[model samples]
Target: MSFEKTWYSLNEAIEKFGLEKGLILKWIEDGLVRAEEIDGKVERVNVDDLDLKVQEMTGI
Candidate 1:
């Protein structure tokens, strides 16, 4: 079967979604999206949660 990415680094999410870093960070803080710290340094975003938010924002 094929595999799909379930998570993305903060920078990757920002680049892929064309969203500002601060906005993404705020989402994480507001619990609109989920994130996890990797190696106690990099924060990875939950792709599914982010996609849902995008859909809500765009009404698509």
Candidate 2:
């Protein structure tokens, strides 16, 4: 993975994590995943951050 890539939309993140979009959004709101609001609507999660959480949860 490249360091330059650091962002993901709600849907993209869902597919990446194999979780539902609603769950991803809930995680964001729960302060589990860092997110930024772009275009005043879209939520983008840091790809690196998402990966970190996956590793933490699964120990893989």
Candidate 3:
């Protein structure tokens, strides 16, 4: 599977990872994962980075 070119919205991440929106939002708040503003206003996260963060946060 391709890990590149797949950016995820905040909502998508919550559903995809089965994680709380608040937790993902906290990651954005804490600058744990870098958020990019696409189309000028939509905030999106990189899947690759998110994966790394999950590993870091979960230590698994």
Residue ranges of candidate 2 with Cα displaced over 4 Å: 1-3, 38-40
Query: If scored against the real structure, what TM-score would every candidate get?
Result: 0.85, 0.69, 0.67
List clashing residue pairs in candidate 3.
none
Error of 2 at 9 (Å): 1.0
Clashing pairs in 2: none
> Each model's C-alpha lDDT?
0.87, 0.78, 0.75
Superior by lDDT: candidate 1 or candidate 3: 1
Give RMSD (Å) of candidate 1 vs. truth. 2.0
Which tens-of-lDDT digit does each residue in 9-51 have in candidate 2? 8778888789777766776778878899967665788777778
Q: Write the per-residue lDDT of candidate 1 for residues 1-60, one digit (tens) a residue.
A: 549998999999998899898888888889999999768654899888989989999999
- State, as a TM-score between 0 and 1, how close model 3 is to the true structure: 0.67
Question: What's the candidate order when arranged by decreasing TM-score?
Answer: 1, 2, 3
Candidate 2 displacement at residue 30 in angstroms: 2.0
- What value of lDDT does candidate 2 attain over all alpha carbons? 0.78
What is the descending lDDT order? 1, 2, 3
Off by over 4 Å in 3: 1-3, 38-42
